[model samples]
Structures are given as C-alpha cells and as structure tokens.
Target: MENGILARRRRELITGAVVLAALAVLPLPIADVYTRNLIIITLLFAGLAQAWNILGGYCGQISLGHALYFGAGAYVATLLFVNAGFPPLIGMFVGGAVGGLLALLVGWPCFRLSGHYYAIATVVVGEIGYLLFLNWDYVGGATGVYVPFKGDSWLALQFKTQKLPYHYVTLAFAAAAWFAAWLIEGSRWGFAWRAVRDDVVAARSLGVRVFASKMAAAAISGFFTGLGGAIFAQYVGYIDPESVLGGQFSILIALPAVLGGVGTLWGPVVGAAVLMPVSELSRSYLGGSGRGFDLMLYGALIVVVALARPQGLVSLLGRRRERARAA
Candidate 1:
C-alpha cells in the first residue's frame, strides 16, 4: 500500500511537471493576436481569482467589493507613474500597500457582520470607491488614466514587440499566486483560516483568533489582488472607474474560486480557466443572436454547474481519483 501510494504520488508529480512545461512554451508557434490575448486574459483572471480565494474561499469572507483593492492598485500605480515618474514596475508595491490599507480599513469594521451583511458592506465600500474615483479628476475621473508609452522599458515592464512577453508575464503572476495559495493551504495560518471559515463561534471557543485570522486573510488577499490590478493596468495601458472598479469586476474575481472548488488551492485557477472561455465564446457567438443572450448563457452555465456539482467541478475529478486509488 505504501509503495502504491508513493508510486501514485510520483506519477502525479511527473504529470503535473510535464503539463506545466508544455504550457511554458505554448506561445512559441502561435502568432494570432486574438488567441494570444485570450490566453493572457485567462491567466490574468486566474491570478485575480486565486488572490481572492485567500479570503473568500479559505476564510469564508464573501466580499462583493474586491474590485476596490484591484482598482486601487491600478490607479495608485498609474498615478505614481504619470505624476512622479516613479515607473509602474516600482509603483506596484505602492498599489499593493494601498490595497492592504483599504482592506485594513474595511475588514476591521465589516468583520463584525456575518454572511450577507458582510458581503453587502463590502459592496457599499466598493461603490463608494467607484463613485469617488468617477468624480475625482486627479486620476482622470470617468475618462480613465493611461500609462504613458515612452518606448520599451523593462524597468517599466513595457514590451512593444509582441504579446508573447505579456503571455509569459501574466503566466508568471498566475503561477506565483498559485504557489502562494498552495503554501498557505498547508500552513498554520491556513488551518486557522479553515477553522474560522467552518464556524466562527466554534473557532473562537477553541482559542482561535477569529478576527485576526479573517483580517490577515483579507489583507493578504487585497495585497495580491492589488498587485494583479497594477499588472492589469500596466498591461492594458488604461484604467477607469467603471472598467476596473465596478461590481462586475468583483463578481468575476470571486465567482471563479467558488465555481471551481472553494478552499482548494487550484479552485480559482480551474474556475477562471473554465469560466473565461465560456464567457468569451458566449459573448462572441451569441451577442447578435439575442439581447443579453451571452449573460443568459453564462447564468445557465453557473446554475447548471452549481446544481450538478455543489462541491464544484474539481470534486468530480477528485472522486474519480479516489476511486482509482481504491481500485
């Protein structure tokens, strides 16, 4: 039995390594902009979702206003770059710090609420940020801010030649976020988060610092989400209130982890991969077929997936693996 377990683990490791290797070089032959852009977008969402998973999935803090942090990262970095000539590559930290700061401000008060109330509070905070930025002309208001394209500078993380560099950069961010999630999933903090997630009252009784756990998770989540925003703004060379700081952005960020398998390391990544393609394809092919047809398709998919597998699509595969081991 021990030998079999070890062999299975080794095989799985090898297979995972092989898949990653293939993906690392996937862009060598592809030259089409659409396909490359799709890959980059998928990776972008994956990183954002994974960051969100730290709080939402692990700590059970269902925030509907996560875009607050994401937009902060983008706007702050862009502002620093445009005004101070700080360069976005360096200002990314400022963006992350701002995100953590916002989380600190909100999580303290909002953590007092439970379930839907907490979620609603987050949405309100996000809306406030959105409206404030929409009116504040310093950051370009509703017109949005654009990163000055001063030729190609690696220090600024600007690449002018092709989308290939972006593909790898986004992949790096996704991979790094995934690795962080993996580490946190197995750490002492991870256990505390899981405890708090399962039952706050019960966890407190067991000497768990419920508030601290949730707050830590939220701060970390915001920090990474903010980093993603910085990368996104820099990559797109644009940032606007409606585009980055909206409720839709929050929904897309949080939904992927839940749809994949909340509390699991790769849940958000899997969810992003599945959700993005479906959404894009639906919007592309079904847009002219009927008004709101793409949204209808997306809704149908979420409902079907939720009803068919409440534990998520990952659970289905997990069960198969369990059966294989049993056999």
Candidate 2:
C-alpha cells in the first residue's frame, strides 16, 4: 500500500510539472497573434469554468447565472477605477467580495430548491442583475464602462506591449484556483460538499448542514468567477452587458466544465484548451459566411458529447487507463 501510494504521488507530481512547463512556454511557439490571443482567452475561460465548478460541479448545483458574478466583478473594478480613481488592482478584490456577497443573497433563497428549480432561480436572478445594469446610467447603462488607457502599469492592470504579462497573471490565478480546488477535494468542507452532491438527504441524515455547505460553496465559487471577470476587464479594457454578462457568457463559461468533466479538477482547463481553439477556428472560417454558425457548432458538439460520452471528454483518459491496466 505504501509503495502504491508513493507511485501515485510520484505520477501526480510529474504530471503537474509537465503541464506547468508546457504552459510556461505556451505562447512562444504560436507566431500568429490571433492564435495567441485565442490561447489567452482560453486561459481566462478556464479560470471561470473552474470557479463555477466549485459549486456546480462539486456541489451538484447547476447555476446558469454565473455571469452575474462575472459582471459584478468587472463593474466593481471599472467603477472604482473610472469614477473614484482607484487602482483596478485594489478594485478587483472588492469586486470578488461583492461577488461573494451577491452569491450569498442569491443562494439564500435559491438553495431551498434543488435540481432544475435551483437552476431556473439562478437564471432569473442573473437576468434581474443584467436588466438593472442595462438601465442604470451610473454604470454606463447599456453602453457599459471602459478602463482608461493610463499606459502600461501593473498597478493599473494595463499592458501596452506584449500580452505575456496578461497570460502570466491569468496563469497564476488559474493555478491558484486549481490549487484551491485540489485542497478542497481533500478538506472536510470538500467531503461535506461531496456528500451533499451524492445524496443530499443522506448527507443531512449524517448531520451535515446542507444549506450552509451549499451557501459556502456558492459564495466561494462566485468570488473566483468575479476575479476572472475583473481580470478580463483589465485585459480587454472594455465592457458591456452583451459582452460581459447574460446567458451567453454563462453558457460559454460553463462549456468547458461540461465538455471536459464537471467534477474533475483539471476538467475545465482541458475543456477550455480544446474548445476555445476550435471555436475560434470556426469563427475565423465561418464568420463572414453567415451568423450563428459558431453557435450551431457549439450546440452540436455539446449534444454529441452528451449523447456519446455523458461522462465527458476527460472520461476517455480514464477509460484508456483502465484498458491499459486490464491489458
């Protein structure tokens, strides 16, 4: 047993090392700016999906309103930077806190209902936030606010030249998010969340505080999603309701988790890595021909994956490993 445990640890460490090494130099090989930009975008999406996974994946609570948290973070940082002259660096954390607070508000009423009812409630709450932002002129209304160009400065979260800084920042956060997930998987909270996931009634019978566990998961999940939003705002230097919030962003953010494997730690990252590049390619190729092509392709892929491999793309690796062991 000891030898087996050591071997697994050895394998995990090596796998982690290799992945980090590859991501470290990921941009060096890609000469095309469009492709590089697509990669950067993928990193951001990976973070968002991973954040969502904390609640949706582990807790088995499918939230279709994650865009609210994302937009909250973006708007918070932008409002502070633009109106209060506060550095976005500071505003990002505040935005994350706001996301957490909002999650508590949404989860308080919604957690009472499970499954699809919970999801529907989330969608409603998300739309409410979107409409409020759309009509509120203080936040630029439907037009949205833009981050000022104050030259390249880390404090301002602005970069004038290469996109390397942005990539590193995202990579760091993605790593941190992944690390958090990893820790949670081993912690008591993680066990409670998983218990609730497997059987909520049984978990409650076991003395688990089901509501509190769900609420904690939601708040933490929202906090990270909000951070992803703030990072995106800084990187793009612009924001709008259509671009930053709504069901589309929610779907896009969740796509990776759905495609990769919702409950698995590295699923979102792998899914985003695969999906983003393909979607970008479709956009590049079919963009001029007509509209909705990209959306159609994404929809088709999701349906096919659901039908053919309900366990998700990551299951393929597990199956291969099982086969190897049998062989």
- What TM-scores do the predictions have? 0.93, 0.95
Candidate 1 regions exceeding 4 Å error are 1-19
* 61-88 per-residue lDDT for model 2 (tens digits): 9999999999999999888999998998
Q: After superposition, how far is residue 11 of candidate 2 from its true place, in Å?
A: 4.2
Please report, in order, the local distance difference test score of every candidate based on alpha carbons: 0.87, 0.87
Q: Flag regions of model 2 displaced more than 4 Å.
A: 1-14
Cα deviation of 126 in candidate 2 (Å)? 0.4
